[model samples]
Target: MLVKSIEKRVQELNGNLELSLDDIFYTVCQEYNLNAVVIEEALGCKCPFALIGFITTLKSADPGNYIQYKY
Candidate 1:
C-alpha cells in the first residue's frame, strides 16, 4: 500500500518534470523508505540519473519546504 503510494507520487513528480530513473529510485528510498532494488526492478533503470532528475523536479516544484495545504 505504502509502496504504491510512493510509486504514484514518484510518477506524478516525474510527470511534472524531466527526471532520470535513478533520481526517482533514490528519492523514493530516501523520502518514502522504499527499497532500491524494488524500485530499480519496477522502473527498469540502473543508473542514478533518473533519481537525480526526479529530485530536481521535486525541489523545483516544492522549494523552501512550504506546505500549501493540510489534509
Candidate 2:
C-alpha cells in the first residue's frame, strides 16, 4: 500500500519541478498514511538515509538504493 502510494505520488510529481524532495516525501507519506519511521524501517535505514534512498529510487530504479554488494 505504501509502495503504491509512493508510486502514485511519484507519477503525479514527475513533471512538477516545484516540488522539492521534502515535499515529495511528505506527500508520499501522507498519501500512504505512513510515518517516516515506517519508511525508514522498510528501507532498512534511518531518517535522511531512507529519504535519500527513496529519492534515489524515485529518480532511477538503482539497485544501490536497496543494498550494496561487494565482491
Indicate which candidate wins on TM-score: 2
Model 1, 1-71: lDDT tens digits are 44356557777656756776656556656665435665366447754445444435555464233222234
TM-score of each: 0.42, 0.44
lDDT, candidates in the order shown: 0.53, 0.54
Off by over 4 Å in 2: 37-71
Q: List the candidate 1 regions with Cα displacement exceeding 4 Å.
A: 35-71
Clashes of each: 9, 0
Residue-wise C-alpha lDDT for candidate 2, range 1-71, written one tens digit per residue: 44454565666765588976666666665554446555566666443325544654554454343332334
Clash list (residue pairs), candidate 1: 19-53, 20-50, 21-50, 22-50, 22-51, 23-50, 23-51, 23-52, 24-51
